[model samples]
Structure formats: C-alpha cells, structure tokens
Target: MEWAEFTEQSHKGRASWTAIQPENKRTATDNALALKEFFQRFPEYQNRKFYITGSFTSESYGGVYVPTLTNLVIKMIQNGTLPNVKLVGMAVGNGELSADQQTNSAVDLLYYRGMLGMQQFDSLKSCCVDNYDQPLTYCNFSQFVVVDDFGNLSPNNNTNDPKAIQCGKLITSFAMDSVWATANDVYNSYQDCYNFTSLSSGGLKGEAGRRTWKAIMGSKRLRASVQQSQDLQSMFSTGSNPFVDQGALYNQGSTDAMGGFACYMDSATQVYLNLPQVRKALHIPDSLPPWVDCNIPVNSQYYHQQNHDMTPVFQSIIDSGYHLNMLIYNGDVDMACNFLGDEWFMENLAGSVYKFNLLSDRFAWNYTRGSFLPQLGGYVKSWSNYNTTSIDLLTVKGAGHFVPTDRPGPALQMIYNFMHTGNYNNSVPFSLDPQPLLPQFAAPPKPSFTRKQADRVWSLPGVTYELNFKQYSGYLNGVPGNYLHYW
Candidate 1:
C-alpha cells in the first residue's frame, strides 16, 4: 500500500495510518488478495510453503490476520479463485494478544521484580481484583500518581489527603521512576538509556557503538500510552483508541526514549530513513512526512473492530486441519507483553480450548555464546494435537521486549529449531562426552600496567575473563565524586 493511502490527515491535524489499526478487518482481505496476486504473477512458486513471524504489536496483527488470510486463501483455492498456497505455521514474540492479560501481568511483574511494595501490591490485588478491570471509584491502581502533559506530577485529582500524597510518591518512586524517568525503558530494565547528545558527544563510539545504536533505534517505537491505559468503553467501542490512551506514557515524563530494546532520546533510524539517498532507494516520495517509529495519530484513532482476545482465531486455525504449528515466545523480562501472561494464555488454550495433550513439561533451554559454557537461555513447554498440529510456549531468560536483539544467538537457534525440529531442544550441536583436558601451564606474572590502562582493558567491548577467585567490586559514593574500587 502507498504511504499516502495508508495514512490520512485527521481532523485533529495528525496523520493517522490505517494499515496498523488493530481492528481493521479489511487488512486481512487485502493481504489475502495481495497473496493471490503474487501467486498469479508467479505461478511456479504456488507449491512452496510459507511461515510467518511477527513481534510486538505486529504479532497481535499476525494472530488475527495470518489465520484469516490462510482461511481466505483456502476458500479461494477451493473456489478456483486462486492457486493453492500452503501456510505451514506462525510465530509471535512478546505479542499483545489480550489487553486484560497484558495489563494485569504487568502489575504482577512489577511486584515479582520487587518494584512494588508489599502493602501496595496486596492492596492492588485485593481492590483491583488482581487485574485492571475495576473502576476508579472501586479501585485505583494508577490513581496514586497523576501526571499531566507538561510533566507535572500531582496527587490524583489534586487531592490533599496525606495518605494519598504519600501513596502517590511511593508509586512514583517504585513504579514510574527509573534510569529513564517517565520513559523508563520498560522494554529492558537493565539496559543503559541513550540519547542523541550522548551518541553525538562520543560517549558511545566505534563500530560496536554504531551497531548498538542501530539496534536500539530499529526496535524503539513511539509507544506512549500504547502499552497501558485502555478504558473499558474504548476497548469495546469501535473507532475508539483501544491501543493508545491519554494515560501514563504522556503524563509521566519525556517519551523521547520510549520504545525499543533500551530507552533512547533520539532515533537514528528516523534520521537514516529520511536521508535522500535512502529514500530514493526505497522509492519514498518527498511529499510524505518524515519517518517516525510509531504513528501517534493512528495509535490514537485506530478502531477496535476485531476481537481483542485472539485465542479463538488461533483455535480456528488449529482446527482447520492444515498441519499447522504455532510458536508463542516471550522474553521473560518484558513487562509490556509479559511472559507470564502469554504462558497463561497458551496454557489455557492447551488445557481447555483445544484440549491438546501436553507434549513436554516446562524445562530449561540452554544457549552458548563464544567459548562460554552453556547457560540457561529460557524455559519451554510444548503441546501437540496428535501429529497434525503443535503449539509451543517458550520464554527467553534475561531478554526484554526484543528477544532477537537481546539474545541473538539464542533467538536464531530457537527459530532454526522451530522450523526444523518444532522444539527448542538440540537447537545447536551438543555432546555429552567430555573432551580431553588441556595441559596446565605456569601462571603469568602479575601485570605491570597502570590503573588507567587496566581500567581501559577491563572496559573494552566483548572482553571476558575466567578468574580463579571471586572478586567483589562496585562504585562507592564519595564527597565530591564516585569511586570505583575493588575489594
């Protein structure tokens, strides 16, 4: 679709793209027709099988559109409208399938990660009924702190009650405030936040730095209010903002470094995509607006014409008897579309919806990097419908919202295994037999390098050392400056 046709100027003077609207049923039919046209143009490849993969919001779209497209193509083939096209399966990573599950699981994740106080967690669980479905009059999970568009923080409705104010501060400190403040890089908690100033100032440099910046820019999105704060009315109403809301993302702090693997203030991707040469290569017209990670107008103006819960669509595909396989994977550390909620969704599908027999108990999957020993990559659970269909729910340990960027080796191995073996086990070659030990050598003399040189060496990228003894080292507060000392 052309960019102009995909997006339109809204009455609010914003560009709204219809392509990514969650409830846009026309997208499926369009996609199916596009596929039909593709086969018509290239009849020789009609017998080829295809598999689909999507991440984040695209994953949600895939959940609905992929199956719908498949069904449409099957009908077309039966009716002699189009040639036969085989869809083998699909894979979704950190997908936002159910708003209820995603929203509730985020709170649970906060509590589990020690980001919420015990009392506050208990209160939320009791009052909100373990979810965000309760009305504000009954339970105000986010009522503690109310932030405005100008980054001003105040008590909810400017309440002067002492308890309310304290609760607000507590929630702000624990839930909202982090390394990136309001734009708290919810995708990955442990990653360092970056900005254009930092990047341009040579704080991050060299090819390694450029790669890191590219990865961050490519993954980040303008995810303001898109991750949370959906009202019941909007969720059910058509032509309403079911995805994006006027809640936390805007009110908190700067959304400059919003989406992606880490929080970043600027998008290198936007800069690159807008370049004249790049635009010419991609055939982007000059009349289109400059590129952005996420279309804010589209997010706010999208219609929820389709079912939010996509389990039925998935179940329909499985029952279609197309020898289908589905892989629903999540990064364990991702709070947006959390692993727990996705796990629950898959478990419910297997146990109740499909009545599929459990093929494997949840077990640790390992991955290796460089010469490092095999480490726990994540956990996996599998379900099978005899031999016709299979579903696997897997988690990538220590990964954030973007699993491929977070754990590239593991992610590649996982997808490779899924395509071939239909499971995560034995993704890479492994051997139980022990190899011959190397001959012992004399220990090297203590280094004569200066402390600065040692620091430089230690800070070098991709450097790892095997130490004989455990060493504890950390930064310490000082009068004028912090001290980095080892004990």
Candidate 2:
C-alpha cells in the first residue's frame, strides 16, 4: 500500500511544497482506504490476523494510522464489506506521539546526561520552569551556552546578561551537533561514525569491511539539515507544535537520504537500490523518480488534521471491546524521542484511560550474547485491562534512536517475547545452540566447507570453531557500465 502522492513526494525534496497548497490535504484515512482496497484484491487473506509495527516517524504515523485503520476494518466487518480482518495489536519504537512532551523530555535527558551544567540547568528551570509550553523569546536558554561548529557546547564567558541567558540556543546547538558532529550521534551514541573517505579509499573491504559497515549502518542516526535545526528551534519557539508542522524533526534532506549522520552504508545501499537491474528486479517503474530513504516533499505536503494528541484515538481503541495489545519501546539515549517522554505519555494514558491497571512493576529484561553471561537488556513497565487488552512501555538501556539496529539481540528478544507471550519477560535464559540430542537420534555430521577459496573468504579471523553454515558473495550486473556487490 502507498501513502498519498503528496506525502510521498514531500519526503523526496528539501523544501515544503504543499505549504502553498493548503487545500491539498492528506491523512491516515487515505492510507486506510488503500489498505482496504488491497485486502479486497486478495480475498483469501481477508480473515488473517495481523500485528502492526513501525520505527521512528513511521512509529508516529502508526499511533494515528493504526487505530484509524483498525476502526475502518471494524466498520467493514460489521457491514459485511470484509468478511474478517483481525487487528490484533501494534508495537512502536522511539515514536513521536506527542511533540511537546518529547521536546521537553529531550532537553531534560540532556541535562540528566551532564550535557547541561547545574548552573545552566538551574537558570533554565528558573526561566522556563518545568513546562516548556512558553514562547521561544520568553524561555530562551541558548544565550548562556556557546556551541561551536563541531557541535561542542560550553559556557559563554563573554558576559552574564540575565536577559541573554534566558533559554535560547542550547537545544538548537545540540540539534545541529546531532546532524553534523561525530561526537553526538542522536541515534546510537556508542556506535562509531562511518567515514565516507575511508569507504572510497578501500579502507573498508572484504569480510572485515562488511562487518564494519554492518555495525555502522546498523546503528546509523537520522540526519536533519541546518535549516531543519532552525525549524526545530522554531518549533520550540511555538508551543505545542505538531510533528507534521515541524517537518525538519522527521524529514531527511538529500544528504541525510544519501547517508545519515556519518554517511554510513546508506550511500552504498542507495547505489545498489538505484541500479537498473536491482530496480527492475524490485519492479520499480522507469518513470518513477529515483528511490531515496526519505522524501522531504512528502513530509512537507503531509497533514494530520486530526487532533495532535493521539490519547483519544488510543483510548477509543481500548474502549472498542476488541482484544488488543500495544507496546511502546524506546532507546533510552535517543534525543529524538527520549524514553522519559514516552514514559510520561504512557503514564498519562494509564491514568486517564479507563480499565487500565498497573500489571507489573518496572523490571530489568536481560539477554545473553555468545558465551558471555546474561546482561541487562532494558527495563519494562506494563498495564492491562483484565484479559482483554494490554499496554507496555519499555526502554533499551544503552541504545539510541534505532533500537533494533543499536541493540539487535535485546530488541529481538524483547519483541519476540512480547509477540508470543503478550509481555516483555526474559526470566528464562535464551540460547543459540541447538537443544541436546535424544538418545535414539544419530549425531549430525560435522560441518565443513568443500571449497577452499570460499572458506578463506568466509573464515572468521582469530576464531576456532566448527561452522554450521556457509557464507558466499557475488556480483550483479548494474546499470550497464557498473556492477553491484553483495555478501
């Protein structure tokens, strides 16, 4: 299924295209209709139950679209328009459900992380109080700090003008740093930045290069342009901004689509996807514009006419009487949508929505890696409405914006357990090794590679272990003069 054309187009460009065309509005309902049409075309899968999931901006979209789609499906089923199409539940990671709450918590996270000094933080508290719903001019905190081009922040020693120190540029500086600086990755703070020059000079090659690329790309952060940073500042300036109005917060510019914070493997992925053969294999039409990770034009034209606060939508679903589950997970270190903000949203929902009761105290979930002992994966808190519905809020401890990419093992375990058991519990240890053999069964043959050349390429450096699987690489025909490489 596809989003409205304007929404898709806005994501491709850097500027707002539909700002001039106010009448050209788009919302989740359009996508719901498309999904309904898709189900109609395939009657055989009409009654199948499905779970929805999304990350980042898509997560934000899911908060609105999923419920809308769910209600639409319910109506269809009631009217016999669709025999059946079950909407079991949904999961969202680092979602922007409430912009005001997220922005406020993002600043608070930075302060807690030592990004802000006690004096500066005190000053901010004094000026803006705990609430960030005031005008930008009224709560300017940036004047007290100095932010360099590299995104580094320090106290402004030039002067101590009380008016200047209100609350102006601190968030703006951090926002810019998240986009251009290497030290502050808004996605996964612990991951290394991928240097484009290194890739071009063959610094990353072979299996080692592939591993490095995977690590970098797996934890890659989203990039917003300087203008986008300014837009964020404007968003803070205007209290209670909606995600749609603040395009820069989610939309990716050309450079962002090309790589992301450090140009990670997206550059290569873009090249590979645009390859003539690859596009043809994917059935992409020649007339369509080149594929990009995000389309700025689509973001610019998009509109959410519905209430910005999605609490009502969620409450409506819970009241709908259908058994459902919802999981809102966040990577603790992500500035884009910090865990604190989501925690606040969930807490508010639990208090305001009917039938929800605290089911479990917040507890640590753990995961085991290789031969190492189990480690803290994250923390989880849950609420339930008897046996009919459930909601959970979780945080992946050291991860940033991209939970799965930043902490794949923990993410996989958390998601798997949640999907199967309807809760995030890692009490039982998980293992990768096969189960012990039965007394009657014969032992399997020792794994071995027949080809020496292939073995050499696939061999892990400094490791001594028997393999259960083989690895291979190949080259594919690209756009006439070029070729695509894959492992």
Candidate 3:
C-alpha cells in the first residue's frame, strides 16, 4: 500500500499529494452525487432523518470525505437540487485528521505503548529537539530522521526534498520495524490475527538479533549508508522459516492483516460471515466466494489514491455553521492513528475555524463504580462556539486502532450519550462501571505450541538440526471457519 511513502510525505508539511488527491476526491465526490440521485428517485425516503458515520480514511473518504459529501447534500437541498435530507450528526474514529500530526503522534504512541524502547526514544528525541526545537511528542520523526541522516539538525532543514524524504523514510522504516518486532514480544498476540505465543529461546535469540540490528542502526552513518529497505521488510516477513515461525502462526488463514487486542471478535466474526445460512440470509448467492472482512481491491485503490489530509475539510464544515454535531474520538493505544495527533489536529482549528478560540481545556473521563474507586476511562476535550460545544475530541483507554472492536462497551456508551443528550462529557456516568459492560467471557487465545516445543526439530533450508523428540506441523481448521497452525 506504500504506507511508508504516505507516512513520509505526511510527516513533511504538504499533507496531501497532488498525484493522488484528484482521483481520490473525484471518486468520493462522484459517490456523493450518485447517492443524492438515488435519494431523489425515492422522494418518500428523503423526508426521514439521516445521520452519517464512518471509520478510518477508507470509509470516511480521508476522514473528511463523508462530511464533505453531506455538506454537498445539504447545499443541494437548500438550493432545490434535491429533496430535503436531514443529516443530524456525523462521527469518525481513528481517521486521518492531520497528516503531519498523525505521523508525529504515531511515533510518539509507539514509545508510549512500550513498542519503542527508551533508547530509540532518546535517539529520536535528540533528533527532534535539536532539529525542530520541539519535544519528541510533537516533532515529526520522519523529518528528524532526514536531517539526522544528513548529519545536520538545523531548523531550516529541507525536509520536503525528495531525496531527503526518501532517506528519512528508509531510516524511519528501520527504526519502526525494530520497534514493531519488539512490540510483538510485549503484546504476545500477532497484530494481524489472534495467534498467541511466547517466543521460544530460539525466537528470543532472533529477537536479540533484531535488537542488535537496531543498535547497529542507531548509528546515523551506518543508517544512511544502508540503501536497501527490503532488509526492513524481510525482518518481519511471514515466510516459511523455522527460526521465525510467523508463517505457521499468523499466515495460515491469511489473518495476519488483522489487529491485536482482541481474538474472539476476529475469530467469531469470520465464523459468522462465512456461515452458509447467514450468507444466504444476507442475500449472498452460492456462486459468490466466501466472505472476507476487508475488500482488498478497494483498499488497494484507496491506498493508491490516498492523499487528502481532511483536517481542512473538518475546519471548513465547522466554519460553515451547519449546527450538526461533530465528534472525533479514538482508542488511546491505536498506533495506526493516535489520539494525541487527532487532538492536535482538532485544536489547531480552534482559532482558525472557530471564533474566540473555541477549544476548551482537556479533562479526564473517569469510570466510577458506586462504592469502589474510579478508573480512568480516557480523556475528553471539547470545542465550543458562542456558548455551545459542538466538536469533541476523546479517547478510549486500553483500546487499539479499532475502538468499537477493541472496547465496545465504552464506545457504545459514549455514542449513546452523544446521540441522546449531545453531551460527550455526560457520557459514562460516575455511577456506572464499565467492567461489566465488556464481554465477560472473551479469553485471550491460548498457544498450541509451547516454549517446551523449542527443542523439536524441523526439516528446513538451514540445516538438519535434530530434535530429540518427534515434531509435527499442520493447520488447525477451527469451528470458526478460520485456520491456525503450529510447529
């Protein structure tokens, strides 16, 4: 998907790329036009209230696309181009608000979540502090890397230079890969799927090797000299290898494209979607292929045509005085799109789109049980107009990139409160505890292969290393229609 490319470009100031912006915007704009036409054909449906919602830039059309579409609909209704269609509220989660801010926050979040250790953090911090005069939290690591690669930390560094940006991306990719590999150790579960494992001594040795590579990469001279990014890609590649058994663990069902934090949902959803009865009931023909969660074609198109920042679109909507409620929230643990960056994106619009600097002070949103103490659920910072708060920035604790999928209870509660009362702060009352709301029975996936299996031998390319004990490797087709494997 060239995520690294987008990440690098975003870290620079330009945000959206001219190369992809036109096609992406046109795609979304055309869809909005088609939707308006459909509604026009059905006059009876146009009178009812409608609310719009989406997640990530894919569904949200760069996080601002749906709202932009809605705005167009509103304009059409006002000008008699279409029947009146009421769009009362709009919400987006873990979506792109600001490219630079998102990249900055993502790097910072890796540190916050213990993915990037203190050593890496210190290195990046020095690069940022010396070059940008900003803390690591706010600085663009990509730009910092570019300057650091050049042996200069000057404020006036040409971060946007194509060569510099590529250099920065390569270095950033190496550092991020090291951290991501190490992150698997702490999380245990593969980010793509629910396969869980504690690395064997051999795996630990591989991890140690990865660490050594990272330590060696800490040198700017060495880092800049290394021109090949395939090295970073291969570090985490899911190939048939005995030393690194990611192919057996995560690639069996091709579920490695999923996320960590929740296993049951991932497995169970696959089960439900692939059920023949369910598929038939949902109007699927037997001729069609089995159901998959993601649309790879669409994803690829979005990636190729992905460039819009959407922050400006958000500001445009806010400045339009639409009177519609807008909410932007995310899970705190999301490395894909961090909450802090979204907060920064929203806050930056305060003085520009909002008159009188509408953004209010941030506050913690605690979850309290009647007699017991309160748990910090997350944080909230609201943006106000003349006397009313319309924009909300919030976080869900212990959640990853997908908030609802990760912490459904708090997310639903927050949604209910915002929808019913239009008060984000009033959601999740102090008297209500969220512990009971989450799935009480969902357990983490247990590993089929234990560390004790480390001594078992496998026939592979490297050597005829022997196992004193017998070893077997095969896939386990679970009742949930997904595949798992062990070595």
- TM-scores for all candidates? 0.59, 0.58, 0.57
What is the alpha-carbon lDDT for the whole of candidate 1? 0.55
Instruction: List runs of model 2 lying over 4 Å from the truth.
Output: 1-27, 37-46, 55-60, 74-81, 128-183, 197-263, 279-307, 352-355, 369-372, 426-487
Instruction: Give the Cα lDDT of each candidate.
Output: 0.55, 0.54, 0.51
Residue-wise C-alpha lDDT for candidate 2, range 1-487, written one tens digit per residue: 1121113422212223434432111333454556577777876666566665643323433454555555555555556765666666677787756544554565566666776666655545544554444422223344455533211334455766654443434444342232223345555554444332221113754333333332342233333222223233222111333335545445342233212433344555667799999999989999998976544344324432243446766766666676878788888876655677778778878756564788887998777666768888889888887767788888887776766655666777787777666545443356544345585653454243333333234566676997778665544456886767666
How do all the candidates rank in terms of lDDT, highest first? Answer: 1, 2, 3
Per-candidate Cα RMSD to the true structure, in Å, reads: 18.4, 18.4, 15.6
Q: How many pairs of residues collide in model 2?
A: 24
Query: Which candidate ranks first by TM-score, i.e. highest?
Result: 1
Question: lDDT at 56 for candidate 2?
Answer: 36
Off by over 4 Å in 3: 1-23, 30-49, 55-62, 125-137, 142-171, 174-261, 269-302, 351-356, 367-375, 387-389, 425-487
Highest lDDT scorer: 1
Show the colliding residue pairs in model 3. Answer: 192-258
- Estimate the TM-score for candidate 1: 0.59
Estimate, for each residue in 1-487, the C-alpha lDDT of model 1 and write its tens digit: 1010111112111133444534334655666666677777877766666665543313433444555555565556556787566666667888756544544355566766776666766554433443545422223435665533212233454777776666665544443332113233456655444332221212565333333333332235322212222232213112223365455334222232223323332355667788999999989899989876654344335523254566766666666676777788887876655787777777877878778898899999887655577888899988898877888889888777778766666877788788777656554564333244454532333334333333332233464865454433333445556564544
In the range 263-348, model 3's lDDT, one tens digit per residue, is: 44433565788898899888988898886443333333333324435655665565566667777887775544557777777777
For model 3, what is the error of residue 336's alpha carbon versus the real structure, in angstroms, after optimal superposition? 0.8
In candidate 2, where is summed lDDT lowest over 10 consecutive residues? 1-10
